[model samples]
Target: MTILICNSIIILITKTDPALQTPMYFFLRNFSFLEICYVTVTIPRMLVDLCTQKGNISFLSCAAQMCFVLMLGGVEFFLLTVMAYDCYVAIGNPLNYTIVMNQQVCVQMVAASWISVIPVVIGQTYQIFSLPFCGSNRINHFFCDIPPVLKLVCGEAFVNKIAVYIAVVFFVIIPFLLIIVSYGKIISNILKLTSARGRAKAFSTCSSHLTVVILFYGTASITYLEPKPNQYEGMGKLLSLFYTILIPTLNPIIYTLRNKDIIVALRKLLAKLLA
Candidate 1:
């Protein structure tokens, strides 16, 4: 609920404020919407289970949940990569920033980010669910994540494991590498600015995004990339909780608190409502 409300405020403020009608805030709006969807996929069900003390989910329902999770997660990686490129262009090539990242281009990139994941997620979900589940039905984790679901498979899951690894490389690692490259260029460009104030201002624009990137990629890398041993299963769940729940909650606070534009826009909005 906190995630939803906070992110909704971002979306509302961005849409209503003319000053925020730029490429950066446009991407930020989409990201906040994505965060809302991302949390909704897992947290609500988790909450209900906690309340009822009966964490029961049907096989098809679990498959659907996992599919949405994978899709949303993939979209987030792509969106973050797009955002990194946007930052690079704004800082590295300011003259062409508006021309390059026009409204149509931004919409296309966002649409591609969303659509590109469908086939990959569907194929992966189908492959995982097609396997026989003759073993214990209980999922060790809070959600129907790939790792925990794979554990319940009856037969050898070598192929499934390979597919998952490939997906992670293509969707997660590759995007992260692209973000790193974009930021590298951005940093180089920022340093070239002769004026200290110019450099500081440039850094300020990126600080919020950089913080979000670290919070997201840091927790995600630890959760997904690391070897999942039985001894670390408990640790794994805790890490999953961080990425899935904590990150979404923090994102709105990070952006709104760090961004002066958002702060001013929010204040104006509040004053207008009160008046």
Candidate 2:
């Protein structure tokens, strides 16, 4: 609940403040919205199960949860990639940044991020659920993530596992690579600046975003990409909790606390309300 509210406040601050109308904050607003949806997908259910001591979830409900999780997670990576590009344009080509990242371009990029994930999520969900599940319908992890759920599948899930790896490459690794390339260019451009202040300012603009990218991709990679041994089942759940819950909780703090613009906007909004 706190994470949802904080992220909502980020969305509200960005949307309501005219100073936050740039392509970067535009993407930040969308990212905050994604954060809200991301936590909502898993945390509420986890809380319910904790309170009731009943971890039972219907197959259809589990499927729906997994679908939403995959979609939101995929879109988040795409949005981060877009944000990195936005930073690249702002720092690498300041003169044409406004013209290149105009309103239409930003909207199109966000739309692409949201729309591109649909097929992957749908296909992955269908492929996983369509498999046979005989005896011991227990999912080792908290939610219906790809690996644990795949473990429950009766027979050989090699093909399904392969499909999952392919999807991870597309949804996670590819976007992360794009972000890396964008940041590479951005760093090169920043180094070219003659003034130390200019370099500091440029890096400051991207530091929050870079922090978020690291936190998200780092935890996600560890959780999804690493080999999960039977002895490490508890460790797997802890990693899942980190990405699904902790990352969302930390995002608002990273963006708001680290960002001057967000702090100023928040103060201005608070002043107006108090007045």
Candidate 3:
């Protein structure tokens, strides 16, 4: 809750600024919003559990958690896809970049990513939530995730598992493939640049995004999609912490630090204030 509140306040200020309205900041705003919704879905219950240790989450609350965690997870996956596309266009097509990534198109890209997640997450959440928990109600993790919570149920959660698999295919595989494809073309375009300076600049613009992509996917795949058993109580917990807490916070910082235009704009704004 504290994290959510503090982030909300900061994001509110950032959003009201005219200058923080580019693709990077646009990504930052959406990422911040996702953080608010994401944390709210799980933390309050976890906080209650921490205080009381009894942890009696009602069925409805459990359903809500499942829905939101998957929802936000799906949303985050799609946002990364958009961010990758943004970088690809900015580096690969500088001349038509503004026209290609105009406000309307950017808005649509963000919207399409978000819109694509709803049906997929809703279907998966519904399958998992409606099942009978005729056995242990104790969720091992701090919050209700698909695997930890699924292990507690009595009957075969095969359908739920399948739904989860479908979501994995849609959320992880498809977007990941799209990212790879986009980067391939981006590299091809970068190679075609005649000047060494041009190639270096293109690579620098893409370097931060590729770094983030590798980190996020590396942790997520290892934690959630790995074949290993449930020993991830510690490692899984850490990885979960990364995607949940770390990514959103670090994204804005990555863009500001690495992107030259953003730094120049911010510096100009700061100089005006000092003057």
> Number of clashing pairs, model 1?
0
**Per-prediction TM-score:** 0.98, 0.97, 0.84
Each candidate: RMSD:
0.9, 1.0, 3.1
lDDT of each: 0.92, 0.90, 0.75
| Count of residue pairs whose backbone atoms collide, per candidate | 0, 0, 0
Candidate 3, overall lDDT?
A: 0.75
The digit string of per-residue lDDT tens for model 1 on 110-208 reads: 999988999999999999999999858999999999988988889779899889889989888999999999999999999999999999999989889
| Tens-digit per-residue lDDT, 1-275, candidate 2 | 77988888889889989998889999998999898888889988988988999899999999999999999999998999999999999998899999999999999999999999998899889988999999898888888898788778887888987887788899899999999999999999999999999999999999999999999899887777776544577888898898899888889999998899999999998899999
Ranking according to TM-score, highest score first: 1, 2, 3
Which ranges in model 2 have alpha carbons more than 4 Å from their true place?
228-231
The alpha-carbon lDDT assigned to residue 81 of candidate 3 equals 81
Among residues 3 or more apart in sequence or in different chains, the pairs in candidate 3 whose N, CA or C atoms overlap within 3 Å are none
